[model samples]
Structure formats: structure tokens, C-alpha cells
Target: MRRLRPEPLTPEAFAPFGTVIEADPASAIGINAGFTTRFHALAEVEVEGGAPILSIFRGRPRPLVIDMLERHPSGTQAFVPLGGRPWLAVCAQAPGAPLRAFLARGDQGAQYARGAWHFPLLTLAAQDFLVVDRAAPERNVELADLAEPAQVALDG
Candidate 1:
């Protein structure tokens, strides 16, 4: 197995995938103070293997972080960290706008940006992640003629 650590997470880097964990106003914010929130079930493409494969970090102590992969004239994306060490695996497709990744130590994955590309939540040990995304009759996808790639790393 190989050790994969991408450069600082960025929307341009995560263009191939959709936004990862996003904001949830309903989910429990803490032990007792939380508002209504939403949940992700992994970004789907309505077909068998039509989406990107959930790549596993294959390492231990995965570090998860609360980062934002934003897209500007490129697209939107999310950086979901898996495992204890906090490794991130984004699940997104076709970026259309510019995005930014705001990752931190105490942050959790949240909602998908409007027109922002995103991915499913990936666990370091597991090659599977539950994601939240949007796919309607009208799909939002884009290609970067001259795009750059970003990597996600958590300080967990």
C-alpha cells in the first residue's frame, strides 16, 4: 500500500468529486445543544459503478478534519476525513464554481454547497463512506482545462 498525502486541500484539487460533509443545523451540535440538521448517504450517480470508487487510506490512525473545499470559477468540493489519524476521502463529481476547504481540529463534515461538487464521507479503515449530494434531471458538472489538485490532512 502507498501513503497518499495531497497538498493543502482546495476546491480546485477536489474538482472530480462533489462536496463532502456539509453543515447540519438539525444534527446534535453537542451533548445537549443542537439544532435541526441533515445527513448524507453518499453521493450517487443512479447507476452501477457510475461514480468514483471510495479510495481507502489503508493506513491506521486516520485523521479527520473540518475543512472546506470551495470552488470559484472551477467547482465545489468537500474533504471528508476517515480513520483516527483523520485521513480524508472526498466524493464529488463535476465542479462548476470556485470552492474553499476550511479544515480544522474541532470541525465536523457538513452540507453540500449549491452548485458545488462534493463527495461521500470516507472512513480511513473502510473503503466506504456515507455521503450527501444532489442529482436531478439537470446535472451540474464541469471540467478544468487547467486545474490543480489539493489534498486533505487533519491534525487529529
Candidate 2:
């Protein structure tokens, strides 16, 4: 098993896997008497005829040990944090390749592209997230057991 450190989450770095949703004050469009800002189209929701389902995911803080990963072949999936807390995002180009981690803040969200291998939801606190994903009739998830697990470390 190998240890890996998490990089800061950014739209450019995470572009390969998916989109990073963050409300940037400068980029957001102002509206509502100059009191509201909007970061439009933060992530692309590609369902491809699959029903979009919304669910809530509650997660607790724990050690980051990458033992397995999964992917949705039918459609893309997204996770938007409901609470203000930092969480870890682990992903890889492929199942056998090295895993990369990102530190997502409370305000940030992520949408994984179809067939993107990623770890389950991870967080430091008991935080809830709003998830929008496709509902497929047949099982659309593929899980892979990693031969070697990696311990994810935090980057300063």
C-alpha cells in the first residue's frame, strides 16, 4: 500500500474527471438588488435518459484508506454539500492507475463523469450532501478492489 496526499481542489486540475462547483464572488453574476450571485452551470448533469434521482448522503470523518473504488457506467453523478465542512475526494483515471485526492470545501461540489472511478463520499464531520444521479434499471455500478491501498494525506 502507498500513501498519497490530497491537492487543493480546482476546476482546472479536476477537469479530467469532472467539474468542480464553487461560488466565486468575482465570477458569479449579480442579481436580486445586487444581493445575490450565481455561478451558472457549475457542473454538467448528463443523465442520458436515465432518471435523475436526488438523495441525501450523511458522512462522518474517518481515516482515508483507499481499498476500493466504483464507477457508474450509465450516467454521471454529483454531490453537493449541504453543510459547511471540508471533505476528501479521491479519484483515478482508471482502476489500476494511481489514485489522486482533492480537498473540497463546504461550499464546493463535484460532478463525476460517466465511467469515472472514484471513492465513496468522505468527510471530517457528520455532513449531509445533496446528490443528483441517474436511476438505472440494471445495476450500473462497477466496483474494483485495489490490490494495494493508499493512505491519503493532507497537503499544507
The candidate that wins on lDDT is 2
Off by over 4 Å in 2: 25-27
- Model 2 CA lDDT for position 115: 90
lDDT per residue, candidate 2, 78-156, as tens digits?
9989998988889999887989999998889999999999998889688999998998777878999998899887645
Local accuracy of candidate 1 as per-residue lDDT tens digits, 59-133:
333344323333222223333443323334443335323333333221343334445443234344543233333
lDDT of each: 0.36, 0.87
Candidate 2, TM-score vs. the true structure? 0.91
lDDT of 1 at 92: 36
Clashes of each: 59, 0
